[model samples]
Target: TVIEQYEFCRVHRKEEIIISYKIEKGYPLHIDFTILPNWIKSLKDELLKIIKGQQYSEYHVDAPGYYGTKGLAIILKTLTEMFVQSKILTTNLCIPQLLSQYLAQVLVPKTAIRLIAEDFNNIFLDMAKKIIID
Candidate 1:
């Protein structure tokens, strides 16, 4: 369902990162990086840790659980950090706009929302607070 609803495209060129999402029935959303932010550049080690720490198999399994949502929240949180550190306005962000479409569609079904919400609570709310407080 998530795959059906959203499509992701990523490209790494020389020193730039470009990530885009194509939502069904919605225009494409892009997160283009012409230059790396200092904060992101400094987090090379942390980024490696994040990538290395994931349980990749859980992402591939066809199950109704929090794994997918956890992954999504991680991306969202990372994007949030990027925007904040770059001093970019939230209005320019694209993931939230793309995600809003998916959320709207999921609301109609309501079956998967619980797991998503659980993961959101754990990864986005709780972890974010801890990171900020610390």
Candidate 2:
């Protein structure tokens, strides 16, 4: 009844990790993920194949939209966003080989993560703007 134990794919796990980052100053990449248990791992591979093969999964992103595939979708979305941002920012920012060091010593450690701890000021500002505009 192991499958029965999982109320939802991945989310059914007793633990999940939340990663934080500085979105504006720079969404520095810091992967804080744990390996899935063997039981979940087994099911994930087949499910992942099916999910990735979908042509327009977003078209079906509605209620009850592949609940079993939510975890895979979320992981793909985050990585796509991060890497695409990285590509644009690296070229525009003109950061040299010291990218990792710069992200670590300068951005992440600066102000003791004050900006990050603030839940990103820009996001709040955007929400406020949307509310006012609407």
Candidate 3:
């Protein structure tokens, strides 16, 4: 079947972000994204609020991390899976990113996406703990 016909690979890089999907006709659709530092900073700030208990949302979190809802642990595998006030602020938004409120032009796989989100969230949690929350 279709699922049996194709393979998947994950890619990460500094210049650009890419997500590829295989179509039924055996072709692949490619999506590319550029997330600037300011955008990343804005997202970090949003997560910072949550880490310091300045934010609250539904009780459930995405996966196997004690990160809980303490930060960007919002149980969303894709950026488009926005939970509530959750969003990534940026000046550049493609149509799909705009629709999903996700910074990426395409969907990220389950755990990988959440892991990246948590990694960013943890940055503020780990470094500027007292200045932000206190």
* Residue 46 lDDT in candidate 3: 51
Which candidate number maximizes TM-score? 3
Angstrom error of the Cα, residue 88, model 3: value is 19
Model 2 clashing residue pairs (backbone)? none
User: Candidate 1's residue-wise lDDT over 1-134, tens digit each?
Assistant: 67644433222341133112223312213322222233233444433333333311112222222223443444334444543445442333324344343222321112222223332453443342232222
Full-model lDDT, candidate 1? 0.32
Candidate 3 per-residue lDDT, tens place, 86-111, comes to 64433343332353333222221222
Clash numbers, per candidate: 0, 0, 1
Q: What are the TM-scores, per candidate, against the unseen true structure?
A: 0.21, 0.21, 0.23
Which is better, 2 or 3, measured by TM-score? 3
Q: RMSD of each candidate?
A: 19.0, 18.6, 16.5
**Which regions of candidate 3 deviate over 4 angstroms?**
1-30, 33-38, 59-134
Model 2 over residues 1-134: C-alpha lDDT tens digits?
A: 67755666466343232222123333334422232123233333333333334321211122211112443344333333443344522422324425343323332221122222233353553342232222
Count clashing pairs, candidate 1: 0
- Superposed model 2: Cα runs more than 4 Å off: 1-85, 91-97, 115-134
Give lDDT per model, in order.
0.32, 0.31, 0.32
Which RMSD does model 1 reach against the true structure? 19.0
| Deviation from native of the Cα of residue 74 in model 2, angstroms | 16
Global CA lDDT of candidate 2, please?
0.31
